[model samples]
Target: MEPPELRRAVAAGRVAASELGLQVDDVVVVHNSDRVALRLVPCDVLARVAPVGHLADSEFEVEVARRLNAVDAPVAELDPRVEPRVFLRDAFAISLWTYYEPAESEIAPTDCADAFLRLHAALRHIDLEAPHFTDRVAVALGEVNDRERSPDLPESDRELLSGTLSGLSATISTEHDRDQLLHGEPHPGNLLNTRRGLLFVDLATCCRGPIEFDLAHAPEEVGDHYKGADPVLIHRCRALNWAMFSAWRWRRADQMPDRDRWRATGLDNVRAALDRCHLD
Candidate 1:
């Protein structure tokens, strides 16, 4: 959505909240991407608006958080007073959540790993249907090869991405680790060290996969801290994730401030992953 349209949607969200008896004295834009986050003040609530088709994943995230909270899991809590339902208006889907303020210091990788382990355990109890982790891998590869999606992607890099994705998929399919519910991306960026301690947010990527898949985005220290983690599987997952992320960067390079820098770094990571896989 464009700036004017997003501002309109944010206004619509505030009005929608008012209808539900939630008073919004102010509205602050927290983040914007595929979705827009508005921090509704006085009530201290968050309103997230996304396109219609995208609501399902956001709804799933809310339900998963509800279940995890029941188990005393350390995750971003939803506003329980309001029914967690996706509201549709003007082609946008909105959901309300309790706002969280992070501490001054960033959350350490060790904290992220510890919180992820707890969150993962609680998520296993959620019996909802979720996409497999590899499903995203396929999607990323698709974007890399799609001319309209990645019009600037070089032919040589496209071939390299395709080949690397196939090899990674093969390795993932043969891994011996037990599959379970995963936080999907447990990197430090997705975690917050709040007054309540470390809380995992952005459950939209929650999926069913080997625990190593969740650890792939985390720092090496995080992988080391996680007990019973399969080192070899973690390494393989890292290689796979790097390839996928590299494709993602390439696909969205146009929107980045430093496209050349990002493209260079992404391609470098892709090459590194390919080299590591060959060594193995």
Candidate 2:
């Protein structure tokens, strides 16, 4: 039951690879969600395919990866056989990256933290144009405020999400002096345990923010392992993250699996996080 977009994406990815003179006989879907990621068969290259409108975002990810690779950051590398740039074909944007075989062992919390620390350390010295974390909050807020985007969301829930996003964004912005380049979402799903060690993928969400903001996306235990992270700021950022995720889940266009369950869970997490914040 592949979505129509996924079918188109697979075709676009294969065509893009062939145009680059690479022989891709089959395409294996590595991941499919908001975007489609295909592994070009026989070639062992990962091709991330999205709509044409995401061309700029894909290009941004390629540039970010290039810079991070130069600094030897713990991030995935762009495919070397092809030009290190995005390819557009059949109304989709495609970017090729090195395919890493997954390691059997799960990444420990300490290992995840160490990877994040290394990534952040490298990111600190690299200069790149990226949005601030508040911009992401604003996008979520826009989704909450737009009835068409979240038609199924109750008014009360909408108000709660809007308030949480706005309040936390303002509070977080006040600490902009501590801001630095951050992996906007370092959650477990974005971390890959490979023979090369824990390498991060999906760099499109990179932004300028406090390190606490990135830690909020990781496991709670990870924060304890990351030195110098402010617990209070992490808590607030966690709540904000939940709100943003909830807003995304509520969107009519969101195609995440088990949307109803994730939407409910996200809302519940946001409420619980808010309660804990209030109690503290």
Candidate 3:
């Protein structure tokens, strides 16, 4: 979103929060991409603002959080001050969450693995209907295949991404017996080091897939600590993850920070992963 649109979204979030009887003295942007996350001051509530069209996705995230909280899973919780639901204001979809103060120390790989294991255990009991991991791959595949959507992507690069996504998706799809709800993108960025501990956020990407698919998003060393993880499957999923991210970065409408740098890095990672797989 442009600066003006982002300002409008923040304003919308502030209005929504105020309506919930929270006193907001100031607003601080937590992050900005396709959506904006703002920290409402004094109240210490985090408000996630996205285009109103994303209402369904926001609603899904809230539901996922509620279920996770119910099972005492290590995930961010919705704000107790407001109804646990998506609030629409102006042209933005706003959702309030409890904001955790950041911890001074970073989460260690082993700790991350342990938290992820506990999360997976709790997720096993969740019965929510979610998209399959292939559905996510298809979305990226669609972007790469659409020339207009990825106008800046070179034809050769597009082909590389397309092939990688297709092959890995097919290979991973065969593991239906191991299919279960996954945190979709459990990378370091999504894991918050908070006062409570390392709690995972961004539940919007929740999907059904093999555990290795989720592990692929974490640091390589994390898989070492996560016992029973299939190394080969994790490697394959890592390639797929890179390809998907590369596709997203190439989108003509993507506004992620440092997108160009990430696009180049993603392509490199994908190629490197593929080469390693070939050697193995």
Output the number of the lDDT-best candidate.
3
Model 1 C-alpha lDDT per residue in residues 33-132, reported as the tens digit of each score = 6678899989988888877778788788877777888889888887766887778877788888888876898767677778878877887777777888
Which structure among the candidates has the greatest TM-score?
3
State residue 60's C-alpha deviation in candidate 3, in Å. 0.4
Candidate 3 backbone collisions, by pair: none
The count of residue-pair clashes in candidate 1 stands at 0
Against the hidden reference, what TM-scores do the models get?
Answer: 0.90, 0.96, 0.98
What is the TM-score of candidate 3?
0.98
The lDDT-based order of candidates, best leading, equals: 3, 2, 1
lDDT of each: 0.78, 0.91, 0.93
The C-alpha local distance difference test score for the whole of candidate 2 amounts to 0.91
lDDT of 3 at 54: 90
Q: Per-residue lDDT for 242-273 in model 3, tens only? A: 99999999999999999999999999999999
Residue 196 of model 3, lDDT score: 95
* lDDT per residue as tens, model 2, 148-258: 989999999999999999998998889656999998988888899999999999999999999999999998999999999898889999999999999999998888888
Candidate 2 clashing pairs, residues 3+ apart or interchain: none
